[model samples]
Target chain A: MSALRIALFLILFSFALANENPDAHVFPRPLVIEYPENIEPRFDDEVRLKCASWRFAGEANNLNPWKTIPEECAGYVKDYMTGKGYESDLLRASEEAGVYAQNVELGGDGKDVWVFDVDETLISNLPYYYEHGFGLEVFDSVEFDKWVEKGVAPAIKSSLKLYQDIKRLGFKAFLLTGRSDRHREVTVENLKNAGFQDWDKLVLRLPEDHVKSATTYKSEKRSQMVEEGFRIVGNSGDQWSDLLGSSMSQRSFKLPNPMYFIP
Target chain B: MSALRIALFLILFSFALANENPDAHVFPRPLVIEYPENIEPRFDDEVRLKCASWRFAGEANNLNPWKTIPEECAGYVKDYMTGKGYESDLLRASEEAGVYAQNVELGGDGKDVWVFDVDETLISNLPYYYEHGFGLEVFDSVEFDKWVEKGVAPAIKSSLKLYQDIKRLGFKAFLLTGRSDRHREVTVENLKNAGFQDWDKLVLRLPEDHVKSATTYKSEKRSQMVEEGFRIVGNSGDQWSDLLGSSMSQRSFKLPNPMYFIP
Candidate 1:
C-alpha cells in the first residue's frame, strides 16, 4: 500500500477501537459481575445488618451469613476496584493528604512516617476475587496465599500514585500488613514487582506474635512505631481496623472497600 | 463630570473593589476572624484531643480544655461558613446525594425522608458565633437561646441549595434538631425567614424526652421518624451525633463545624 493509504487505514483502525470501548481508558472492566443473584434488597436494613455483623463480628464457620452478596455490595466492590468514580475519589483523598503532609513541618529525624496497608490497598487482589466469586464463597486461605505468592497482583493505580507523591513529600513510608511472616519474602517480592519501591520498613505478623485481632495487632504495631519516635502523619487503609484503635495516625484515609470484611 | 470620564471612574472603582476582595461572590466575609489570636498550634494533637473529648464526652464546666482553639479548627469553621473550598465540597456532596435520591424508587407512601440538622447544617449560627467568640469562651445557653428567639439566623447557602435539590428530587425533608422544643416556634420562623419552605416535619427535643446524651436523643428521634413509615435516604449534620446511633439513613454527610463542640 502507498504511505498515504497506510496512514489512512491506521487512523480508521484507531477510530474503530475507540468506538468499541469509549470508557476503556477511564474505567477498566469491573472485576466482578455487575449483578449477583440471591442477594436482593440491596442497601436495605437487612443488608446493612449483615454487613455490620460481618464487619464487627467475624464470619461464622468460614461462611458469610448471606447466601449471596447484594447487588449494591457487588457494585461497591466493582466501583472501587475498577470504576472512574473510585479513581477520582482516591485522587481527591490523596490530594488532600498531600496538602496535610506538606503542611506539617517534619523534624527530619527519620521519624516522619506514613503507614500503608498491603492487600486490596497498594496492590489489589481483584483478579483473585474475580475468579473466586467475589466473597460469596468462604475465604480459602491456602488459595489466597498461593495467589499472593504469584507476586503479580496489579497496583491500585491511584494508591500507587499517592505512594509516590507522599514519598516525594519526604514521608518515611511504612508498610504494615496483616499478612503472616511466612509470606514476607513473597510479599516483598510482590510489592517490588507491583511498582512499590524503597519503603522504609515492611512490618508483618510474626509466627509467634499471636494477637487478639487484626485491629489489636495493627494498633500495637503502630504504637510501637510511635514509641520509636516516629510521627505518623498519614495512614491509608481499606479496612477500618487498619486506621482505627490506639496510637492512631494524625490523619487516616479509608479507601473504598466492600468486598470482604476484615476484623 | 463628562459622561465618558464618569463611566471610566466607576469602572476603576469597581475594579478596586474586586481586587480588594475577589472571593466575595461565593464566600461572604467569614463570620470568624481569618486569624484568631492565641489559637496557635492549629492542627496539632492538642486540638485533636480536645475536639475528640468534646465530641465523645461532651463539655466540662462549660469550657473547652484548650485555652485557645487550633488555627485549623477556626479555619475549618471559617472555610465552611465562608470559603470557596467549602462551597465546592458541599456542592459535590449534594450532587452525590442527588444521584442517590434520584435513583431510589420511593414507595410514594409519604415515607421517603431526608433528615437535616438545624444549627450549622441548614441555617447557620455564624452570626451568633461571630459575636460570641466562636467557642473560645464558655457557651452561654441563655444568650444562644435569645439568639435563636431572634429568628434570624441565615441559611447555610450550600445546605439550602441541597435542601432545595433534594426536595426537587422528591425526598421529604425533615428538620430534626437538638434544639429544645421551646424554640420550635422561633425555629420555624427562622427557617421560613431564612428561605426554607414546605419541610415535612420539624422535630425538637421536648422537655419530657430527657435522654442521657444528645446521641441518644437524636437517635431516638430518628428511630421515631422511621416508625412513622419514613425511609430516610439521606441524613446530614454538623455533629456526628446527628448521623450516628440507630436507624441511620442510607447515607450521611457531615458539614464541617469546628467552632463549637456539640454532643
Candidate 2:
C-alpha cells in the first residue's frame, strides 16, 4: 500500500511537471484608443478631406480604365442574382430598361411596383475609380459629374441580383438613386449597360426639399410606392440610408458590403 | 546601434537556449476527439459517450451563466433592436415571445409581423443541460418535458435584451423554432416569465417533417408572412434558420450563438 501511494504521488508529480508551461513568449494585449473628452469643431480642410475620400477622390478611375469586369465578381453577381430568382431577358429592349416585375397583392387589390436607391446605393463607379487609384487627393465635382454623365459605373452585382429577383417575383424593379436629378440620363444608360430593363421610375434626389430627409431617402420612396397603390414587398440596399425612411414597407433587406459607406 | 543589435541577438539566443527543452517534457497536443462528426451515423449510446467527454465536459464552472428578463442583457439588446427600428408592441411581443426583431417596418395595412427561431436562436437551454452532469442519459422525454415545463433555465441576457428591444419596436413578433410543436406551451411560458408579451406565432418543427433542406422552412415562413399580407420589416435570431427564410423581406438580422446548431 505504501509503495502504491509513492507510485501514485510520483505519477501525479510527473503529470504536473509534464503539464507545466516552459519559457514562452507572451503576446502583448492590443491597445485601445479612447474618444476625446471634448468635441471639436470641423474645419474646412477636414471637410474637404472627408468629401474627397468619400466622393470625389478617384475621378479619373471613374472614367473606366479596366477593359473588362473581374471574372470572380461577375460570377458572384450572376450566381447571386440567379439565386434570388432573376430570369434572363433575352429581348434587348426589355433588358435596357432595368425593369422586372413581381406579383404583389395588398388588401385584395393587386398593383405593380418598383424600388431603388442612390449614391453607392445605386450605381457605383467607385470600383472603377478604386482600381485606378484615382481621387485620393482632390475633390473634383467636375470630374465626378462627368463620370455620372457618362453613366459608366455598373450596378453592384449583388444589388443587381436582388433587382432581378424582385422582377422574377413579378413586380417592376425601379431605379431610385441619390444621384441629382440632372444625372438621370447617364444613370439610366449605366443601368442599361449593366443588364437592367424596364425601370418604370428613375426617382432622383431632388435638388430641393420635396422630401423630408435626403439621408433617409427610402422612407420617401415608400410613400411613393403607397401612393401608387403598389404593395412594396421587398426593399434592398447596401446602407441603412436606403431603409431608414421606408418605415411602411413590407420588408427591407441589406446586402453585404466590405468596401464603402454612404456617409 | 551596433551594440544594441548585438545585445538583441544575444537576448534572442539566450531565449532560444532556455527553451531548448532538454527534458523534452513538451506536453502532447490535447486529444481532439471528433465527436461532432461522430454524433451523426453512430448509435445513440456512442453519441452519448462522445458527448460526455466532449469539450462541453468538465468546464461547467467557467461557463458564466446569465439571465435576460432577470436583467443582464438589456443594454446590448436595446441598442441593437432600437437601431434596427423595432419600436412598439411588435418589439414588446417579441420580448414576450422570447426572440429578437430587427429592421421592422409597418405594413400599409395593420398586419403586424415578425419572425424568430428555436434552439439557441431563441432560448439557450443547452448550458443548463450540458452544464450539470446531465447528459443524454437524463434526456428522456419525461425529464426533458419536465424541464421544458419549468421554462426557467435562466434566460441568456443578450437574447433577452434583444427580445425586449424587439417588443419595444411595436410589431408582433413570432417564434419559429426547430423544436417539436409539442414543446410550444413550455416555450411560450418560459418566454412570458422572462417578461415578453407579444408572441404572434411559434412555428415549431413537426415531428414527422423536420425542415431538412437549407432553404425550405424559412421559405415557407416568409411565404406565410407574404400570404398573410404581413410586411415583415425585420427578422432576427441566432441561427441562420431564422433570417434565411425572409430572403425577400425588407430586412434580415442575425445574432451570435455559441451553443447549438441544426446542420
* Model 1 Cα lDDT, one tens digit per residue, B1-263: 35754453344223323333322443334332354545544455544433432322121111222343444456444433454444444444454555566677877777889999999888767667777656555778899887787666666666776788888878899999888998888888778766789999998888866554677888888898888888988887766668667787777666555466665
The top-ranked prediction according to TM-score is 1
Name the candidate that leads on lDDT. Answer: 1
Q: Tell me candidate 2's fraction of native contacts, as a decimal between 0 and 1.
A: 0.00
> Per-residue lDDT of B1-263 in model 2, one digit per residue for the tens?
65864453344333322333322211111111112322233334333332222211111111112221112222322221222211221222234333323333455365666665644445545434443222323235466565566555334344455655665667767776666677777777666654456777778767654636434666776787779777766666654445543334454444433233332
- TM-score for every candidate vs. truth? 0.47, 0.38
What is the TM-score of chain A, computed separately for every candidate?
Answer: 0.73, 0.51
| Model 1 B-chain TM | 0.72
Docking class of 2: incorrect
What local lDDT does model 1 show for residue A107?
A: 78
- Mark the regions of model 1 whose C-alpha exceeds 4 Å error after superposition: A1-263, B1-27, B30-68, B71-81
TM-score of chain B of each: 0.72, 0.51
lDDT of each: 0.64, 0.43
